[model samples]
Target: MPLDRRSLLLGSPFLLSGCVTSPATQRPSQAAISRPDMVEADYASIYAAVDGEPFPVPAIDLQEIEPEFLRRAVGYRTAERPGTVVVDPGERYAYLVGEGGRAIRYGIGVGKEEGFNFRGAATIARKAQWPRWTPTPDMIRREPQRYGRYAGGLAGGAGNPLGPRALYLYRDGRDTLYRLHGTVEPWTIGTMVSSGCIRLLNQDIMDLYRRVPVGSRVVVLGSGGGTAV
Candidate 1:
């Protein structure tokens, strides 16, 4: 008997070893790991896949996200106070909206203008590791070149831009037509760059995802929207 490729993918969350590689290419080193049908991913491999290789001249250390980094984080917010995230596009900072008039801030990458921009309130409905991608029909219809190829859907693993994890957002108990997902493009951390979906570095998004869970609260101050994450 032979283990199918799908089985290898849909296996356990702990399947990956503690090696955070990008989710774009499967290096030979990855095949060495074992599988229990499907297991929990160590998350390291996913980083390797989507993350660009370190260059000869490192752009920026950016290894550790310090308080200064928070100052650079972009998202929507009204005032600084702990509660839920309230993304304010006008300011480009996703304020964790802290308590006692403070917020754990994080820079964010927003969508481009027009079709790429969307405003609404939602919650972190669900999450996944190396989540498969099935572009919405609207996305395909709007830009077939970018999505027609994957109409059937994209499987989890290296090459999927969603990186290590995904924080699915919902509104009115339905997918709010957006997501706060991880990306390999780390430099885009604090800018508008997606189709209304919030993008974060694999490391940062992973960090945020860990802190929040399904049903957690999220308030997108952009265009006045709020919900539970």
Candidate 2:
């Protein structure tokens, strides 16, 4: 059978880590409601296709996605400083902390298995545009027919699972093997699907890439209490 998005995301490699199992309760504050000034055309432009890249990123069909999962600014209550990245897996959301209780929020697709999720603080040690992807030894061992052909690694391109950009996460100068990356499967946002990586829409990740830099802090919150790895 040909490899599909489900195969690619579910079989992707990630280092095992602890995560909280409780559900999240916080929603966007009333102050952070959707911008009334933003019309349908605004969303169209926001998810529009781009021209300058190694590969063409097609526009997203908004109708295919729930409006709640679209990118937007929201009122977030957090102690993290501006430029910090906070991921709440239970909520299927990620926040780019900003000044004055505000944050730019993006919908995210997390690991399907709770045990596969990594909860803790990390740093954006590296960033890549259209990064390469390689299945891990364990993944290959378990599913050789699915991952064996790509032992040499898959190149960055439109067909690659990492999509257009990737933010590499690390701790204490060591790679954690977790990533905040883009996905071509836009409809997967706000769901539990990936092996472990925190995935965002290609357009959203590209937008985040422009604003965040290497060395930025990242905090992945636990389901109930905010726990750190």
User: Best by lDDT, which number?
Assistant: 2
In order, candidate lDDTs are 0.50, 0.74
Instruction: Report residue 13 deviation for candidate 1 (angstroms).
Output: 32
Worst 10 residues of 1 by lDDT: 14-23
Across residues 1-229, which tens digit of lDDT does each residue of candidate 1 receive?
A: 2123243233221101101111133321333222211212333443243234231111223553332333322232344234466665544556555434444455676665544444655777788876666666665665577457767767665455565677777778887656676654566566655556666666556556655658767766555442212
lDDT of candidate model 2 versus the reference = 0.74
Per-prediction count of colliding residue pairs? 55, 0
Give the best candidate by TM-score. Answer: 2
TM per candidate comes to: 0.60, 0.83
Q: Please report how far candidate 1 places residue 15 from its true position, in Å.
A: 32
Tens-digit lDDT string for candidate 2 (1-229): 2236654454444433211011111222223233321213256767877667879888888898888888877777787888899999998888887766777888898887887888899999999999887767776676688668877777788877778999999999998988888886788888887778888988888877877889999999886632222
The superposed Cα distance between candidate 1 and the true structure at residue 45, in angstroms, equals 18
